[model samples]
Target: MTTLIVLPLLWRTRAPFTSLLCITVAGFVYLATDGPGQPLPYSPLVAIFTVAAQGGLRQRRFAIGLGLPLIAVSVAIRTNTAREYLFAFFLFTMVYVLGVLARTRQAYTEAVELRAAELEKARQAEAERAVERERARIAREMHDILSHAVSLMIVQAEAGPLVVRSDPERAEAAFDAIAGAGRDAMVQLRRMLGVLKDEPSAAGEPSTSRSPQPTLAGLEDLVGEVRRTGLPVTLAVEGRPRPLAPDVQVTVYRVVQEALTNVLRHAGATTVSVRLTWTPDDRLTVSVENDAADVPGPRVRPGPDTGGGRGLVGIRERAAAHGGTAAAGPGPGGRGYRVAVDLPVVVSSPTEVRR
Candidate 1:
């Protein structure tokens, strides 16, 4: 009979409720038949513990319902004393409570591990997004720098040979402009490449020793360089001047640069007008308009062979980055091309401005 009661415990993990029922019945038979004296009921306790630890709500309730009566009867069969009944009840209750604690601890551990895995996955996704954004930013900067430089060089190159035999000094100036543009492009490209280098500086930060970004003050130089191409260009700035963040300045400069490059490459214009209007509402509006050239070439968009479509797209991106807007279309009366951008000026503190 004792062997019968012990045998059902083998299925405790796989079929805990069935194991507990079998053990309970065998135990009742053991007690009723007046079997050999045993100090405690071991197999029933083990089966009840397994059911409480591994079984669901219904199975656990069944275990408890059946265990209470089985424990009472076993204790009553063993000794008709209050102390023995109390002790047996306390032992079974303690085992059930322990099994419940083990189950809760297992659930908590699994939950923590699952939460940690989710957080790690999210962190990796964010890291990949950051890399993609950085690549896009670098692509835009490269496009702006290269397009403006190449446009100026092309204009100067086309005119250099035409005037070389007839006008030596003008040809010399054209050659000089080409050289200047090439050198400027090279410098900018070198600076860009330097950012990718893994060499750390003395402060353990990436090396960032490069020239300062172009500002509104450099617009005069820009206009003069384009004027050397024999295309009449005018710049007009209105309203009170105010400080702007470095990023805002770069956005403004690139917008104007791309606009002028488009005028040179696409619009065969006689005269171009660049305007910077600072309104009283903390907004700056940039406008570039060109009149149709006296001898217009084939009407084609700029950078057709050299990634042209991105110019306007890039201008819009820059504007949108600063919570601004850009519009490009025909000038007044549809005479020529016009590009305009409106930017909200964000002033940064002195500490935020890089020297």
Candidate 2:
């Protein structure tokens, strides 16, 4: 009877329910036959523990139904004193509770591991999205810089030869404009590349020495550069001037830059107007409008080579990045084209406000 009860325990892990049933039946038979006494039923206790820890819900419930009666009978046959019976009962109950705790801990561990894996996956996805957004931003910046520069250069190059023989000074100025635009494009490209470089440059200086992003202060320089292309442009400001965050300034500058570039490439307008309005409601509105051309001159749509149709899209993206909105359509009275953006501004506290 002892051999039969003990031997079935080997199968506890692989077949916990069957092992428990065999051990329990042998224990009952051992008790009935008045088998040799033991301080405690070791095999039956181990089998019950294994079943509780490893068996499914229904299997564990069956073990519970069998365990109480087996413990009752074994204690009844082994001891008459209430103290001995209570002690035996306590041992069985403690072992069963320990098995239940082991099962709960294992389940909790698995659940925690699963949650950790899910969080890691979400983190990786967010990182990939951030990389994609950065790539798009860089592409937009490159397009704006090259498109504006190349457009100005093209206009100057086309007109330079026309006056080269008749007017030496005017032809020289146009050539100079072409050279200036090329040089400016190179400088801006270098600055952008510097930001991306991880190592020191050829001169041994770290590439972190890049220029700051363009802001409202550079608006005059930008307007003058385009004016050199023989296109008349004016700038106006309304309301109080105040400080703006660096990103907001960049958005404002890029919006105007793209708007002017589009005008030069496609509008054929004789004059352009750029206006900035700082409203009382803590908003900044940027407007770039070009008058209708008196006579249709050279005009080009953004073709495949010219990054066609992306200029307006880039403007809107820049505005949206700053929680702003962009609109482009015909100017007032449907005479010309206008690009406008509305941007929210951070209000300055009294202490931070300029006198």
Candidate 3:
């Protein structure tokens, strides 16, 4: 009989209502058989606490209603004086308080656990986003390095013969520039591979670098090499130039590199102009223009917004990443193709402007 009242409590978590009902029925049976004159068993106390702790207010009330009546009957039949009834009522009240407190504590603990789980999920998502951004940056670096190197190399390779026949001295310089471009491209590729090697994968595997990233300072070497291809690419500067963040300068460098690569690969222009201007408001503006490619249609095409394209879309993404903007298309009067970019520079080095 005692087991019948308490055994149903095992279902309290999964089937709380059914467990409460079973406990109530067993309690009534115990009272009927034992008679109200007898002391109430400990089973009723356990059932009352379990129901109150496991259920909502409605369930707690139902269990309390059933138990209270039985408690009153037992006190009425067994007690000869008021003192016993008072003691029993005091004991029942304490147990009821204990159950309510336990329920509240349980709900609070569950709520905390739910919030913690949500925070962990959000943290993982943010980590994934950072990794994606880093990967995109690295991809742009490699594209600019390889595309510019290969395009210059191809042009010099083709022009090497003509220059050799007409002017031996210039021909040697062109060949040397081609070799330099090849070596530079190889060094950059190796550095990229090293970065990949250093980046530990999720599985804890290491990928396996030297050479600093390219910057605007390195453009002189680049322009000299491009000029070796028998093209007139002039550079101009306006406004005072300030030191920029390494990453910001890299973006500017790549925008120029990618744009020039487009000219070398697709544009049939002999004369191109590169311009750099610094605004009074902590910004750098870069533009490259060349006589239109002989081929019909635009030399550069639009790519997706996510970047990684060698076309105008990639330029837009790179600019937008740094809170900047870019535009590329046929120049005015249909005389040439032009690419222009505006990049923000939050950090500045010492004041210096190179002409």
Cα lDDT tens digits, model 1, 1-355, are 8889899888889999999899888878877787887734788788878887899999999778877887787777778799998998998999899889888998999999999999999999999999987888788899989888888998888888888999999999989998999999999888778767756779998776777887777777888878887888999888866788888888888888888888778746888999988899999999999987657532234543856579899889889989999999989998888899999978764422211
Clashing pairs in 3: 194-208, 197-207, 197-208, 268-293
TM-score of 3: 0.80
Per TM-score, the best of the predicted structures is: 2
**Model 2 lDDT on a 0 to 1 scale:** 0.83
Itemize residue pairs with steric clashes in candidate 1.
none
Off by over 4 Å in 2: 36-40, 201-207, 294-305, 347-355
lDDT (C-alpha, whole model) for all candidates? 0.83, 0.83, 0.76
Residues 196-250 of candidate 3: C-alpha lDDT, one tens digit per residue? 7686656877642246777778777667777767777888878878888777777
Instruction: Rank by lDDT, highest first.
Output: 1, 2, 3
Query: How many pairs collide in each candidate, listed in order?
Result: 0, 1, 4
TM-score of each: 0.86, 0.90, 0.80
Least accurate stretch of 10 residues (summed lDDT) in model 3? 297-306
| lDDT-better candidate, 1 vs 3 | 1
